[model samples]
Target: MRKLGTARPISQKQSARKEGTRSLAKHHHKSFAKKSRSYSSTTAAMAQQNLNSLLQWSTENTVAPGATQPSSDPARQPAQLDPALLAQLLGGPSDADLMRQAMTAILSPEMPQDQKMIAWDNLEQLIESIDNAMNLTPLGMWAPLVQQLDAEESGSRMMAAWCISTAVQNNVKAQEAMLATGAVEKLAGLVLGDADQGVRKKACNALSSECRNFQAGMDELVKSLPEDVWKGKAVDAAEMDSVDEVIGKLREIAARQS
Candidate 1:
């Protein structure tokens, strides 16, 4: 038979100490698990928040009133509101405009074409708000946003191009204000390669008008128009004029520049 030794309990304090050590170890393990879970939960939460922000920015960049986004389809673009015009509205009520907006909101779904015409009027009002003789700085601030909206959609680009053309033709001060802010470059960018040929034509027409205003400093741009646009489309491809007209004007500017 193997010899057996009897175990000795040294004291009650020893047992208590051993029990306390086990209790401490168990508490430590539980705390560690809790901490791990907290870290994992925080990581998941951060990832979800990032995804949400990206979605928000994507929608905003695509359809945020005046921001520009070319469509996934070449034939379409996002809708636009006149940022300058709307912002101006926020500052004070123009009774006529508010009435117009109410009418538009009510009739837009039922009579889109008519609504579009009224919308065009509203767009003009927005442009003209900047042309107010007293508000030069406000108009200047709006130039970039208007330029951004110019690229957003064809309908909007039409308003911008035409309004600018009218301004250059009739309002010397508005032309000066817009041009000083490089509105011509912005307008040219709006027209070039636009999805709507009409918009492109309007753009060229607007630029041509500005160039004719010899004081606007857009003459150099006029003189630079070649027989063909950079995309190899003759100016007539805009569907607005004959190539001869474009060439003649360019020749005119060339002669003037000389």
Candidate 2:
């Protein structure tokens, strides 16, 4: 009877030990699963944050001290183009020479930000004033500017796109020349890939202008743009709207040409 009692208690202890071991194992598994889930959620949230940051525009404003303010009176604003300088640039110096000088001023690392802005403004006006005479061919004034579309400085890229738009607007010769430089593809890439809103907008403007009333230009622009860009993959809502607007304009142009 004493042995039986001792053996029965031992059996109970062994059963309890087995139950405790199973419970511990179950707890450990649950803990590991919870940790894995937590780690995955954290990683996903971090990735989402990074994606949002990349899509968001910088809100920093750095206005130059002496920058001109907007004026209600049209005459108060500085002339966009200096007539004498335009004539000299177009007729006196070769397009290559003028482009080199403008690019040097615009791209110089040591140049003041304000000065760079001035250079861009001047370049835009010069290209606009010259119209089709700016020559966007391989050896034209716009060759260097097209290369600047990929510049490290966002401001430079924006200005370059703006200049290309101004140069190609309503100028079939300039459009053809720009196309020859493979600018259509480059501009489309900017429209789809550039993070800067200003740069993208300017690139879209350039594409719209290039495609206006020109069948060949329209074809080139459409072909250069990727289907994914129009589908709005990875683009923010606002940026997607901008892309849509550009596509709408291009389609309109195509319809008109057809």
Candidate 3:
């Protein structure tokens, strides 16, 4: 509204100039918004990356710094294996102390059963690391803690046959070393007389090696063992059947081979 007596004249050029300025302001606002969105997204991504790196660093330094000496408290075993230490072990550390510690930890009753199983799987790895250093399992290579592998119980006896068989399969020197223990007669006896098929099956595997070795145990297995040993009723129905089936197969295979 103009004053009653006063009239202001507008020019086309000025009106166009004012409209252009308004248009420029709108474009600037949209551009600023787009740049702000991009900056925020990038900031969030970088922050996530930094957090991940810190977590990895914390675990490596605190939990299991590889090659770092474990605590002196014999009872203070690591609650969990450090991912970093596992990785290093896979990458190959030749430290005998580390290898021994890892092996001992595997069979340690203090460790969870699942961890102990994993430790068993790692034995081949330890064997590879230590093979060149000694011929047979070094004196005190394992321990007296878990002597199931050495006991006289059915399961223990079975594992003993298994261990001897494995020793033979793994190394010729191991075969000679184990055979000298006179474990072969015990294994053949199990194959013929033990009621547990697990013991029988392992005995068969052990005897297979014995036969191939031309050991006298093979004669005992072939000539002296009973024919109906396979039909003996299993004491452990659920666990024993699988091993019995295996022993039956071995008999069939041996018959065919003969």
* CA RMSD, predictions in order: 30.7, 29.6, 30.2
Query: What C-alpha lDDT do the candidate models reach, one value each?
Result: 0.46, 0.59, 0.46
Q: Where's the lowest-lDDT run of ten residues in candidate 2?
A: 1-10
Q: Candidate 2: what lDDT?
A: 0.59
User: lDDT at 163 for candidate 3?
Assistant: 46
lDDT of 1 by residue, 1-258 (tens): 000111122222122222222322343456546677779798578657656655665575465577565658655554454554443333333434332342333234453443343334433444444344224344343363346335445655665576566556545666666667676666555454465666666666667665553433344343343435433332332333444455354333333321
Residue 256 in model 1: shift from native, Å?
Answer: 27
Candidate 3 lDDT over residue span 1-258, tens digit each = 111112122212122222322333344446546777779698578657656765675575464435555588655453554554553334333334433543454445665543343333333233443252243346444333124344444544554455455545535565555455556556656655566767677667765654454434334444444555443332232233554463465555434321
lDDT of model 1 at position 210:
59
- How does model 3 score by TM-score? 0.38
Lowest summed-lDDT stretch of 10 residues in model 1? 1-10
Model 2 misplaced regions, further than 4 Å:
1-100, 131-139, 229-246, 249-258
Cα lDDT tens digits, model 2, 1-258, are: 011111223213223222322333343456546667779798578657655543342222223579665678665554444444453333333334444445566767886654565555545544666532454454446677788988888877878888888888777788778878888889887777677767777787888777666657666765676675354233222244644565675444333321
Candidate 2's TM-score: 0.51
Considering summed lDDT, which 10 consecutive residues are worst modelled in model 3?
Answer: 1-10
Ranking by TM-score: 2, 1, 3
Clash statistics: count for each candidate: 0, 0, 0
RMSD of 3: 30.2
